[model samples]
Target chain A: MKFSPLLDELIRELQVLPGIGPKSAQRMAFFLLERERPRGQRLAKVLDRAMSEIGHCQHCRTFTEQDLCEICANPKRAAVRQLCVVETPADLAALEQTHLYSGRYFVLMGHLSPLDGIGPAELGLDRLAQRLDEEQLEELILATNPTIEGEATAFYIANLARERGVKVTRIAHGVPVGGELELVDGTTLSHSLSGRRPLE
Target chain B: MKFSPLLDELIRELQVLPGIGPKSAQRMAFFLLERERPRGQRLAKVLDRAMSEIGHCQHCRTFTEQDLCEICANPKRAAVRQLCVVETPADLAALEQTHLYSGRYFVLMGHLSPLDGIGPAELGLDRLAQRLDEEQLEELILATNPTIEGEATAFYIANLARERGVKVTRIAHGVPVGGELELVDGTTLSHSLSGRRPLE
Candidate 1:
């Protein structure tokens, strides 16, 4: 009933990847088996090592093999005393691309979702509080997404920062660059209006 | 500039999978590192095995770990003495799903394309010819795709079978069942008209 047992198992296992369905998985398997066996073997080795060896940075919780990530270990970044809290390492990467801020980051890994049982403790707020207390942070920048859950997580963290006399600020919400005014959502337009800044 | 050296290598190597670009590769790498490391490790092992172990069936040229695939090894399938020539193992699987063919198959793996330097030898036509010479085949069915290259391959193989005195036939081309006639293409419509059969 099956074509090849190993090929079938490979296809099934490949579906663990996001957005890859059975058809795509089959294509990938066939491509690897037919055209790129050596490359596929290399991928296997790297993928296995990445999965088994990579762990969270002790300081920032971003993925890293080392105890402290590069950003966390940098003394100059630490001297800035400006900590940007983001929901994931992907968000940290996005911010780093802009070259706008020279501060360190704390990755929460996920946002608060009570319905899904994700809460403050799950987001590592205790670890964040420890950083705030020990580092005497100048400011805590909230770069969580603008979703309802993201907003709730940001608000919760803001209260925690307030209790410790740490000033908290959120990334600005507005129309995205190159986006049309009419295409912008109502909530985003309202936030843009309320959070307006003076012209330079 | 990079997140982690190992993570970067993993993401780059993952791009060898078809349709996985930089963004999807990053997401896949992070998803494995974050949520599914155990499953990812298992996938790596299976993928490595599939890439390294799977080889073409000696008789049919279909993908299999063994020299003779399950279909080729079965005596009843060989007893049918019918051989279907297909462009790929995927096509064989598709035909099997219809449950209309109980015979064995020969997979070309790819159609002829002179521009790409693939010819009869690359397609293992010599191996196919050996089967024609030795098997005393009752019938040879051309089920290659309906493309120009598929047509040329079918024609070439038909001559080969004719010279060997094996009955040669082709799968028909027509409007697909359950498809709208108005939406059918001109070439397929013409083929349908020329290949028409009388109503039962």
Candidate 2:
């Protein structure tokens, strides 16, 4: 009457992923069964390994299989004497793609939101403090999101860095390079105006 | 420098599914890593089983683990003497949900598209012929899509059924129920007018 038991089960399990609805789930299930079985099997193998093996990087707290992530394991990166803090590993990857920062990184995994019971402890502030003490960092960059909780998290981390005599800087806020000035939000425009730098 | 090796592999493998791009794949990987580990592990298990075990039902050609699908295995359905043929399992499910038809089904899995080299053998027309002879089906209903290829497929199957002295019918092409007449496509509106039934 319905899809075979295993097929039905596969469709239901697929809905556990965000943004997958019933129709999309069915399509994905059928697609895998009809044509992409080998790829789907590989996805399963990779997913199993990643879910079981991947854990936080010991030094930077980003998702990794090893005790220390690649960036954290690099002596040259640590010798740069600066640390960039971000809300998620995705943010870290985005910044890394720019190749502008040679310093190390600390990924929060999530921003501070007390209502959801995510605070300094959950953000691994203690580990960050320990790193600051041992690494003797010169500067700390706050590259968390521009939202309220992100700002609050940045402010808290900034205070921690200041107490350790480490200079703290937040990424600049402005109209994005490819964006229209007239289309920019009022608050961002005001921040851009106040934080403006004159040409040499 | 990049996501940890396993995490990177997981993200890449996730993109093997249709409609998942790099960003969405990353999000799905992170989502599974961050909070849905158990569900992710279960998905891996189910996906493995479904990909390895599920195959086309021997009788109906729908995806199923069993040799014959539930409808095809049912004696009462066989005795109904009516057989509805559809393009896919999803289409069969749609008709089943309506509770309008009381018969077994044959799933083509795809329509006739010789330009893509999908010929009679590929559509399992030979198996369909075998079913017509063996099942003693009174009427064969073609529920394929109202597309050029679907029509061609229906016409071919209708010829097959006529050769075996079995009655053949094609589901009507018309303006859809619960749709506005003005917004209906010209082809569908014209078909609806030409295929109009007398109100009793």
Candidate 3:
């Protein structure tokens, strides 16, 4: 209450983001104002630039500041033969961190959940199909999360990809590192046990 | 890794804010890109505009987009005989929230911590003295936090104000509402007990 209008505006704007409550927003507003005025300015500039300039890549639906994102622009990106499908840009970042996936990425941005009113069109399935038709992809890896919605979306996309004669794969999932037997839920432990394979 | 340049830029800018670690920065980055792009843009715009346009109010030392902030610009506020001194604009907000302080404010935006090389000049105590001379303040309330640095800063300013024949008073220190005695640490409990008064 009765905060500087600039602080008020910044806090209000910050509150619009996910998980940032009023108190945290106010703390952030004060901290930013105290430490670096330019930092706040730069954030605002980036936001303005991003909102005004960035758009979805024509091919992969990933956000881009230019006509195509750097991934799509790279000639050596293995875009022609291999592709990794993910639910959002965050997943893409996670995959990229491994430095193992040299293939191109297709970000769905959301999963298909009819209950949430998200469908094939909303998840960009038609765009993926178009990309599949245009590119000579040998394989399509469904690297979505292991959640129910992620599974349903992966299955739907895999079915569509299979119809077009492309190979489909799902990432393996089970108990995570440092997981405890007593604490692990039944379904997940069962899945871990069932999905076990020879170590050799 | 392998994030778009724009994404990388936004994340870098976000990291400049205090207490925002890399993980929270990443979450904020994705949240901005996905759910609140428009709001993010607006926030960014305000940040940019405020940063580029705002400066300290000549009279109070608080940030303002113009020569004086709205509070400092108001005739009613300037007409008040009491002056509240605070460590930062946030402290001013806390007092303003109570709607109990009808006086004007003078924000220090810092505290005197000589160990960290901060002193009277760094905290703009000289400027505050000048403001006190300019305005015929009936009372000057020291609203700094009750930390060691805050206490030192308060006494230093209080002494200075007394030398100039201006009345100076520090805000109270006491146990907060809903606070339990067992939960409170020793030093705080001592301060609260010493500062306690007889019931009216």
Prediction 1 TM-score vs. true: 0.98
Q: Between the candidate structures 1 and 2, which one is better when assessed by lDDT?
A: 1
* Backbone clashes in model 2, listed as residue pairs: none
Q: What's candidate 1's DockQ score?
A: 0.84
What would the per-residue lDDT of candidate 2 be over residues B1-200, giving only the tens digit for each residue? 27888888998999988899989999999898899999999999999999999988898898889998888888888779898989999999999999889899999999999888899999999999999998887899999999998899999999999999999998998988899998999999999999999999
Residue pairs with colliding backbones in model 3 are A44-B44
lDDT of each: 0.93, 0.92, 0.82
Q: Which runs of model 2 end up more than 4 angstroms from their true locations?
A: none
User: TM-score of model 3 relative to the true fold?
Assistant: 0.90
Task: Judge the docking of candidate 1 as incorrect, acceptable, medium or high.
Answer: high
In terms of docking quality, how is candidate 3 classified? medium
TM-score of candidate 2 relative to the true fold: 0.98
Docking class for model 2 is: high
